[model samples]
Target: MENAQAVAPKSANSKQNSARRHRFWKQFFTYLYMVILAIIVMYPVLITFITAFKDANVQAFVLDFGGKWTLVNFKNLFTQTLYGSWYLNTMIISVSCMVIQVIVVTLAGYVYSRYRFAGKKFSLMFFIIIQMVPTMAALTAYYVLANMLNALDHYWFLTAIYIGGGIPQNTWLMKGYFDNVPYDLDESAKLDGAGNFKIFWSIVLPLVKPMIAVQALWAFMSPVQDYLMAKFLLTSESHYTVAVGLQTFINNAQNQQVVLFSAGAILVAFPIAALFFYLQRFFVSGLLAGGSKG
Candidate 1:
């Protein structure tokens, strides 16, 4: 009986020690994995930042920790290139696309959620089907159409293309989010003598602001990061977007401005990163809620 009592305490102590060691290892590995991933992701950004500030005499491709930092790369970026014009053009397109897309998608989503019309179900299914087709598949058609219309190098024409491509999926996402909102609110507003537009503007719109922010962010980013479409559409240096303009710096062996390219790349991230941080609170909620039903 005494032996059994003593053995019980020993077994419990051993089990407790083993569990503590297991938990310690689990936590240690989890932190190690996170640290490894952080380093991997941050390495390129760190290199770019360092390269952007290095002296003009230093080779841009060569990684050197010891160097004089200078602002000549940025100075050359604006003075030597058409970066100002490209930045303006890109900003115009992005803002125009964001506003127009938000209005169109919000209205379309509302209609699909609240109203029954001819071919409504078929239209919804059609959108889903068409969204499955990758944008690359239609590049040839876009190019031919642009050529035929003489819309090449037109910023508004490029904006229209972006807005058209975005509508189907964005509308679907918006509609799913709208579906989550109770119809009772709409009915109550109607009963209180509110018109359709009033209820939408005053009631439903506020509730779906998160999804709108998400949609706006998506719309804004489309032109900012696009390389292939912008390259194909805009040919004139005067009308180029930042993405296309930045590419010119290293497009050929003769015109390699690697440090300048790094500087431009760093500046390009500011607007996007600022907008993202501002809307980040809404981002996750909007995506999750919009996707919940659909």
Candidate 2:
């Protein structure tokens, strides 16, 4: 009986030790996986940052850490290239798209969520169908339409396309968010003689600021990151957005200003990174809450 009790304690200790080892390995592997992923993701960004600061004479593609660093790449990027104009053009398009998209999507969403209008279900379904069609499929149509309107190379025209292309999906997202807000607030506001616009602008809009921030961020980033649509539409170098303008640096063998491209790429990140950091608090919550309904 004494031997049995002593063996039981030893067995219990062994089992506890085994469980601890298992947990240790599990956590170790999980952390290892995260570290591996972080390295993979940060590698390009790190290399780009390194290359952007390296001497202009150094081979841009070679990953050399010991090379002398200079600010000439950035200096040439702004002075030699039309980077300033491209940056301004891109900012205009992005900001305009954000403003217009927010206003249109918010109104559409509020109407869809609060009103019982004719063909509402059909319209919503139509929006889903529109969303299913890839933007690439409509590129030819866009070009043709732009040609017909003589609006090729126009920033306003490109901005309109960005705004219109996003409307259907953004409307659905906004409507889903609007649905989560209580209707009692609208009723209570009505009792105080609040008009429809007053209820929407004052009461409901405040509730969905997170989603609006998400929409604005999305709208802002669309033109900033997009290469294909801008490349296809804008023929003039002067009219080009930063995405297209930056491509000109490396589009041909003779024009391959790799160092300048890297510098421009780094600078391009500033506005986006700033905006993201500003809106990040709302970004995850907005996406989650807005997507919850739809």
Candidate 3:
């Protein structure tokens, strides 16, 4: 009887240990897969960053993984190029676009979410259809319009494109977020003698702040990284954004500054990477809330 009891408990202990081992391997493999995927995705950027500090030679730019490093890329990027002008131009466009996009998107969202007007459904559907169409499809028309207005070289013209192009999808996103807010809040504000605009400004806006940040980041980043529209619109080298400016390095027939391009790309990436990391919490939550409703 004593032998039988000991044997039964030992078998149960062995089963428990086997189950724990299975679970440990499962979790370990899952994490290992994720780490591998992350490395694959980031490999190019990592290589570019590594190449940025190396000398601008055929071997340094293309062949070697690691070698003697120097700061010449950074020095050349600043001194031999209009990188500062490009940075300033992009900053101006991005800031302006962000401000305009937020206001327009918020207003459209508020009206659609709160008020019912004739053709409201049709208008919203129109916007949804518009979002399905690629912005590049309208590039020719935009170019013609810019030419007619002589706004081809204007940074504000690019700013308008960023705001206008983003409005359809962004307004839809904002509307979805607004739909989640309780109508009771609006009614309560009204009972306190608050007007419609006042309620929207003071009561409603505060609740959707995360979505605002999301839209602001989108607006800013779109113009910052955009090469196509800026390329078509901005005629002068001085007005080039980082994307357009960076192209010059590769396109230069006489002196291809590949290492310098890598350095400049890294500089352009830093602020955007930092901003995304800072606002990531709000960004994910806002995306969830914004996409929750019809």
Model 3, stretches more than 4 Å misplaced?
Answer: 1-14, 62-70, 252-255
RMSD to native for every prediction? 1.8, 1.8, 2.7
| Candidate 1 deviation (Cα RMSD) | 1.8
Report lDDT (CA) for all predictions: 0.88, 0.88, 0.89
Model 2 segments more than 4 A misplaced:
60-63
lDDT of 1: 0.88
Estimate, for each residue in 1-294, the C-alpha lDDT of model 2 and write its tens digit: 999998999999999999999999999999999999999988888788788887767655755688678898888877888999999999999999999998998899899999998998999899999988778888998999999999999988899989988898888888888898999999999999999889988999999887888888998899898999999999999999999998888889975778888899999987689889999888677677766766
User: Which pairs clash in model 2?
Assistant: none
Clashes of each: 0, 0, 0
Can you tell me which runs of candidate 1 are displaced by over 4 Å?
A: 60-65, 253-255
Q: Candidate 1, after superposition: displacement of residue 89 in Å?
A: 1.2
TM agreement with the true structure for every prediction: 0.93, 0.93, 0.87
- Which pairs of residues clash in candidate 1, taking residues 3 or more apart in a chain or in different chains? none
- Over 1-294, each residue of candidate 3 has an lDDT whose tens digit, in order, gives 999998999999999999999999999999999999998888887888888888877453443565787988888878888998898899999999999899999999999999999999999999999988888989999899999998999977778878889999889889888888899999999999999889999999999998899889999999998999999999899889999999998897778778888899999998899999989998787777766754
